[model samples]
Target: MQIDFTPDPRLYPFQSRWFDGSRGRLHYLDEGDGPPILLCHGNPTWSFLYRDIIVALRDRFRCIAPDYLGFGLSERPAGFGYKIDEHAQVVGEFVDHLGLDGYLTMGQDWGGPISMAVAVERAERVRGVVLGNTWFWPADTFSTKAFSRVMSSPPMQYAVLHRNFFVERLIPAGTRDRPSAAVMEHYRAVQPSAEARKGVAEMPKQILAAHPLLARLAREVPAKLGAKPALFVWGMKDFAFRPGPTLPRMRTAFPDHVVVELPDAKHFIQEDAPDRISAAIIERFG
Candidate 1:
């Protein structure tokens, strides 16, 4: 059942639309006109993450950003098994149900892998990819493992389960520009309680646990990733996936693709450099 989405018009102004998805009623923003542009967000975030981008590009493109099964305004049923593969499957179901073939895709954070997974299944359907601060490699690097351990610690779990720190602090911290008070409020308000934040606990842990899945995706996704137009708009200031690891691996993955790094931005480039991102999308895949 849809719950607690008192939309702050200044924040997420778009109308909420739903799809009778494989995982119940999936909520999305279907706006504007022309070729479809699919924006996939990551953990602890929803379609709302792409609100700015949607508003920026909706004039020329049909922007469809969906909240995953247990995210945003979507139904987060108990014991939903929020796995990587399952998330990828629903994306496929979402596009298929809408009969969208030959469209654009943009992914950030966990949205990166999810879009790649969807591309594996629906390559022919995808026109190109807007690769933001995200990667597709297995979580085996020293940097990745270290991030996983820190995130899985007792303090972290307490923050996620009780304090709603992931939504409150981390998302804002990821942005170099620092989102406004209203923006941050809407971010936290979407998942107002502990129960609403269940997916938060499971989502990041997958980065640690999905090595096998990532390995398989590593082997399979590369063959198809470069088949379409790919533009890598990276946030160079990202602490998690900076010069240490994520960016390099992604660089190797899409060697031929265009990469525009934003030194001013952090992990959440969407918040920091939405106009630049939107411009890149228009130039490369518009």
Candidate 2:
């Protein structure tokens, strides 16, 4: 899988692997050799988001992180609907294609719903779960509903597709320890064109459009995965998924759950406190 852009090797030092699954050629990183831990990413980011965690725990854990089609170095096919349910379907296919079993699932932001959708479907194969500032239920709150309406508006949609709003603004806004210029470029370069950013643009719409899917997840996730050992590493300062109702829902869903709150960290906990997240994963599931 040849990407048009080159990531700063210093920041993303891992071999690129390709999975020609049912959808298309998907880009992913498969590192280390142990009990597999599937790392699922959210919007505007890719497998690159999990680089530090992969490097930190590759020695003991098999880290398999894939870029959903239309998001990273993966091939974005024409006419593909970049919906959350579609992404989950593709991820589930990717999981089945790889024949992964007895693995821990880790997700943040949109990654939570996407990967958990996969986990619930393959409940027997999964071991433990790790989640961070993310939600899997319908957007009913005033804040989230307002956010969806604003981001899904025509002007904001244009900004996301044409101006690279998520990578340029949201990414930095959501993180406490800001990413460097070079690191930011890696994000920008992945979706350099408006056509390339269709996936990015669609996600904001999914916040509203994917209500049915999210509602199903809310019911199914707890019912299927409530007993699994879960770790919640929350970024307390995240404006989007703030320390509020979402966390409580997670607690209710996963009874055997440990909460590690990071007061300093923001939304992108993988970026803000990868070391702490890595340490917590090692302590809990290592």
Clashes of 2: 0
lDDT of 1 by residue, 152-258 (tens): 88889788878998887888789886788888877787787878787777777889787777887787766786666678898889876774566566656666688
Measured by lDDT, the strongest candidate is 2
Residue 111 lDDT, candidate 2, scale 0-100: 96
Estimate candidate 2's RMSD in Å: 1.2
* Model 2 weakest lDDT span, ten residues long: 1-10
True lDDT of residue 149, candidate 1:
81
User: Which pairs in model 1 have colliding backbones?
Assistant: 102-125
lDDT of 2 by residue, 136-245 (tens): 89997998899889999999999998999999999999999789898888899999888889998999889989999899999999999999999999999999898787
TM-score of each: 0.95, 0.98
Candidate with best TM-score: 2
Global Cα RMSD, each model: 1.6, 1.2
